[model samples]
Target: MPTLKQKPKQRPFCFSVKGHVKILRLVLTVTSMTFFIIAQAPEPYIVITGFEVTIIFFFIVLYTVRLDRLVNCVFWPLLDVINSMVAAVFMILISMLALIPETTTYIVIGGVFGLAASVFCIADGALIYRKLLFNPSGPYQKTAVHDRF
Candidate 1:
C-alpha cells in the first residue's frame, strides 16, 4: 500500500513518441524556413512554410501543456493526425517545388529538410492512427473488457 506522499508516477511528455515527433516537426519547420529565407525563395513558398511553422508551434504548446485533456469538446489526437497529414502533403509539394534544377544551394538544403519533415509527419500520423485504433479515447470510447458478451 502506498502512502499519501507517494503519488503515482507519470511519464514525461517529452519521452513519448508523440512528443518526439512534434519536436522533430518543429525543428524541421524552423530549419527549413530559415534556409528558405536565406535563399530568398519565392514569396508563396515562404508564406506556406511560415503558416506551417505557426501551426506546428501551436500544436506543440497545446500538447505540452496538456490542454488537449482540458478541452473535452475537441478530439485533439484526431485533429493532430489530420494536421500532420495535411502538413506532410504541403511539405512534399513545396519541397518538390524548391528542388528545381535552377534553385540555389540554400533552397536545395531547405527542400531536403522539408522532405524529411514530410516523412516525419507521415510517421506521426500513422503512429497516432494506430494508437487511436488500439486504445480509443474521447466520449464514445468502449473497451473490450467492458463488454458483457
Candidate 2:
C-alpha cells in the first residue's frame, strides 16, 4: 500500500471578536467604496478606501490560517493595532470630505458607511491594545526559542 502524508488542521481564528471586527471592517469598506464609485467621489477618497479594503482583507487571511503564529519575528498584534488606528483616522477624514453640502445621496450614504467603519476600526485597535497591555502572555509577546532534542 502507498502511504500519503497529511497536514494537521488548524482552527479558524476569524470568528472571535477580532475576527468579527475585521469582517465588519471589510464589509463596510466595500460598501463605502461602491457608493463612492456610484457618487463619483474624489480619486483620493476612492483610492484610500480601496487600500483599507485590501489591508483588512490581508489581516483576515493572516488570522484565518494562524500565520501570525508562524511568523514570530514581527509583533503581529502591535502591527495590527497600528494598522487599525491609521485606518480609522483615514476613514474619518475621507468621510468628512464626502459629507459636504451639495453631495449626492450616494455620497452621503458612503460617508455614513465610512463613519461606521472608522468606529469599528477604533474599537478593533482598542481591543488589541488592551490585550497587549493586560495579558502578559499575549500575542504580542515573542515566542521562546528551543533547540531540537
Candidate 3:
C-alpha cells in the first residue's frame, strides 16, 4: 500500500506574500505625512487624518508581517483591504484639492506625495484582493482532514 504525504505547513514568521506592498505602503505613508506637515496648506485636516490612519495601520502591518500566522484570521485581511481602499480614495481627493492654482512649492510637493501614496494604497488594495478573493489555495482556503479506518 502507498502512503499519502501531507504538505508541510508554512512557518509562522515566514516572509509574507504581501511584503513588498506593505513596505511601500509604509514608505508612502511616512512621505505623505512629512510633506503635508511641512507644507503651508490652508487645511491640514485631511493630511492629518491620513497620517494618523497610516501610522496606525503601518504598525499593525509591521506586527502582522513578522507574525504571518495572524494574517490567517479572516478579520485581518478584510480590515486591511477595506482600510487600503478608503485610504486610497481619501488621498486622491485630498491631492486633487491640494492642487489649487496658487499652491506653493511645499504644497505642490505635498500634493505629489499624496498622489503617490494614493497609488500605493490602490496597488496594496488590489494585491490584498488577489490574495483574499482571487487565489483559491490562498490563506483563506479550507483543507479537509482524512483519517484511516
Instruction: State each model's CA lDDT, in order.
Output: 0.86, 0.89, 0.66
TM-score of predicted model 3?
Answer: 0.67
Misplaced by over 4 Å in model 1 are 1-8, 134-149
The TM-score between candidate 2 and the true structure equals 0.81
Q: Is candidate 1 or candidate 3 better by lDDT?
A: 1
Q: Which stretches of model 3 miss by more than 4 angstroms?
A: 1-17, 43-74, 137-149
Q: After superposition, how far is residue 122 of candidate 3 from its true place, in Å?
A: 0.9
Clash total of candidate 2: 0
- Ranked by lDDT from best down, the candidates are 2, 1, 3
Across residues 1-149, which tens digit of lDDT does each residue of candidate 1 receive?
Answer: 87568787767677888889878988997899999999999987789889999988898788778898899998888898898899999999999999976479999999999999999889989877776674455446556965856
lDDT tens digits by residue: candidate 2, 48-110: 999999999888898887898899999989999999999999999999989876479999999
- Clash count per candidate: 0, 0, 0
**Model 2 off-target regions past 4 Å?**
1-11, 134-149
Clashes (candidate 3):
0
Worst-scoring 10-residue span by lDDT in model 2: 140-149
> Cα lDDT for residue 139, model 2?
55
User: What is the lDDT for 93 in model 2?
Assistant: 94
